[model samples]
Target: MLITSGNSMIQSLADTAFAYGRREGDHDTSIPDLTLHIRNTPTEPLHCIYTLSLSLILQGSKQVAIDDRLRICSAGQSMLTTFDLPVISHVTEATRYHPFIGLVLKLDYGLIAQTCTELNLERPSKDLRYQAISTQDIDTGLCDAMSRLLGLHLTPEYIESLAQLYKKEIVIRLLHGSHGMHLRHLASVGSPSRQIVQIVAWMKQNFAQAIGINELADKAHMSASAFRQHFKALTGSSPLQYLKHLRLQEARDQMLLNGLDASQASGVVGYESPSQFSREYSRLFGLPPQKDIQRLRQA
Candidate 1:
C-alpha cells in the first residue's frame, strides 16, 4: 500500500509531467537539468546511455538492463544511475489512455559533494559493491520535491532563482534515501568507486580513441586485475566491454542524428573494419546499422 503522501506526490508529478510531456517524446524543461518523458505504448528495447541522473516513474512501468542485470521500476519508484552507463531499456507497461510518465533530473557530482560536506555525511569504510543503476521506492520527501520542481513549468518567472534550490533539495533527499551509500561512495575522495567514475568520464570523452585496459587501470590508480574487478562490480561490465558499448551507442547516434552511413559511422567511432563494427552493432542492437537507423527513423 502506498503512503498517502507518496500517492499524492505521484498524482502531482503525473499531472505536471503530462502537461509538459503531452507529446510522445522527451520534453526539456525550463528548469535546469530536468526532462520529462511520455510514452503511449510499450516500446522496443532501446540502446542508449544514461548519465548520472535520477528517473522517477510517475505512472506505468519500465525495464532497464545493464549487461545481464535487469531492474523493473513501477509507478512511485525511482531509478538512480550513479555513473554514465550504456543501458538497454523499454517501456514495460503503458497505453494510449494511460501513458507512461517519468521525470529525469541530471545529478551534479559537485553539488553532491558539497551537500555531503554540508550534511556531514561520513564516507563508508569500505566501498560497497553496488551497480551503477539501482531502483528504490521514491522517498516521500523526494517525490514531493520533484513535484514542485515540475510544477515550476506553470510559473516560469521564478525558475531562475528557485530551480537550483529545488534541485538541491532533490539531491539532499536522495542522499538521505536508500541509494545514499552508493552516492556517498561516488562523492568520497579516493574511493575505488569514485576513481572508477573518473575513469568512466575519461572513457566517454575519448571513446573513439584506441583504449587499453592497462592504461585505464593506471588512470584509476589500481592494478589491472583489481581495476577489472571493481569496474565489473560497479558497471556490470569490464573496461573494454563498457568502451565497446559506448562506441556502438555513439555510432548509432551519429547514424540516426547526423545521417552518417554505416561505414562512415563505423570509422568515425574508431572502428577500423566496417564488417567488424556491423557484426558487433548487430549483436548489440539486433540490427545492422542501416536497418537500425531506418527503423528508428520510421518510428
Candidate 2:
C-alpha cells in the first residue's frame, strides 16, 4: 500500500475499533482481519508470528525485535509481513487513553500473485535482500481505496463486491511501488525473498532440530554472509533471529494451543538453559512466560 492509502486505512480502522471500548489497554477485535490493542507499558517481549496478513499501528508506538534488529512503527504508519516471521513485539507507550492499535490482514498468496500478472508487474529475483517496508511511505491513491474498504466494513447494509476490487487495486499499487518487489517475491518462486521463504519453510517443518546457518544458506544457494544480508534485507532480521522467532512462537503455541508447561515447552522448542530462556522470554514478552500463559488462561 502507498503512504496515503496506508495511513487512511489505519485511521478508518482505528475509528472502527475505537468505537468499541472507548479505552482498552490490551484487546483483540477480529474483523475480516485482526485488530490488536496494546496499552501504555514498558513494552512486550513476546515472540512474533512472521507470516499472516499484518498491518500495524492505529495509535501510539511500538518496536518489533528479531535477533538484534528492531523496527519501530507508530500511529499513521503500517507494516506488511509477507512471510511468517518470529520476533518480539512491544508497545513502549500507549494507554486506554491512547492505545497502540494494529491490524492483521489475512494473506492470500494466490490472490496477490494473480493480481500481479494482470498488472504486468515484473517477477522478483530469487533471494530477496530487502522486502518489508514501512506503510508510511505509501501514497494517497492506495490510501483512498483502503479507506473505501474500511468504510464498506462500517456500512452493514452494503453489498461486498466493491471490497474485492479495492483489495486488488491496492495490490496493484504495491506491485508498481518500491515494495511491489516484495509481493512479487512471494508470487515468483526462487527469488531471494522466496529463497529465504524456503529456509523459513524448512525451519517450520523442523523447528525442533538444531539449525546450521550454512545449510540454510545453501538451501537458498547463497553463502552464509550473503544469505544473512539478504535475509535481513527481506525480513529485517538475521538468520538466528529468524530461528529464535520460530522457536519462541512455537513455545507459545505449545502453551496456548497445545497446553504445555513453561519449562517443558521451552526444552521442547530447543532452549538449553531454562533460566536463560525465562530471562529472554521475560525481556521479549514483558512477563515471564508462565505468568503470561496464566493470564491468558484466566482471561
Candidate 3:
C-alpha cells in the first residue's frame, strides 16, 4: 500500500540522516545549504528566526509556534518556511534509543523564481497574502530526492557537480507540492510578499539597532498602512512585534553562547533599559535572563 511504502522511505531517510547527524547537535554537511539536527531529548521552547528553508523531519517530532499558529511535524512530514520569521520551536518526542533526526535545506529564492518562469506558473495576485510557514506530508518523490541529496556526502567529489541539480529537483518538487502557491507568490518579482521578504532580511542584520516602521515601509516602497497590513498578513506579526522577538532571541543567544550577562546582553541587543529587557525577556522565555540561560545550559 502507499502508506507502507511511504513509511519505509521515511525510515530509510532517517537512517541516512542519523549516519551524518550522529552527534547530539546541529551538523553542517559539506553541501553548503544542507544541515542536519540530532536531539536525544525533548527541549524547552527555543526562539529563533527561520529563513527561506525546508525542514524535513525524518524521525521523532517537533512543535513549531509562529505567532499564534502552532504546527506539529513528525516523521514523514516536513515544514516549509517561505520568509524570515521569528519562531519558537522545541522537540516534542525523542529519546536515547530513538533520537530525533531532521534535515534542513536552505532554499534559494532565485532558483524558485527561475523554476516558476520555466514552468510558466501564474503568479498569485499581488493583493493576496500567504502565511510564511506550512507543514505537509513529504511525498515519495521528495523523500527519494532528499535521501539521495544526503547520500551525496559519501562521494564528496560528486557533490560539487551534482548538488545543484538535486537542489533544483527538490525546489521543483516543492513547487508542485502543497507549498507551491505560497512559494510562487513570494518569488514573483515586484510582489508585496517579495518586498516584505527583503525587509525581513534587512531586519535580521540590523535588529541590534533602533528601527522605525515608517522607515522600513519606505524601504519596501509601500505606504505605512499598506506595509503594515501586508507584513502582518505574511508574518503573523506587526513590524514592531517582529522586531521585539528578534531582539529578545538575539539577546538570549548572546547570554547562552557568549557568556554575556543580562545587562550586557540587553545593551548589545539594543534594549535601552535593563529592567524593561528583563521584563520582556521573562515574558517571552518564561524566565529571567540568568535563570533562562542556566536552564538552557543544564539541558
List runs of model 1 lying over 4 Å from the truth: 1-6, 125-127
- Leading candidate by TM-score: 1
lDDT at position 132, candidate 2: 54
Best by lDDT: 3
Q: lDDT tens digits, residues 1-299, model 1?
A: 23331487678778878977689988888888998899999999998889999999988899998888889999888899999888889999999999999889999999999999999998865737665788888877887788888888889998988999999998888888888888888898887889998999899999999979999999999999999998988888889999999999999999999999999999988999999999999999999888889999999
Candidate 2 TM-score, true structure as reference? 0.71
lDDT of 2 by residue, 1-299 (tens): 34432455556766765665455554444234434464644554556675746464667777887556777776766576777766667777676566666555556667787887777766665545544543454356655655565566456455256656766777776677656666777777556666777788788888778878898888889999999987887666778866776787778778987888889888999998888878877766678988988876774
Error (Å) of candidate 3 at residue 146 is: 0.7
Global lDDT scores for all candidate models: 0.88, 0.67, 0.89
lDDT of 1 at 155: 93
Residue 268, model 3, lDDT:
91
> Residue-pair clashes per candidate, as listed?
0, 30, 0
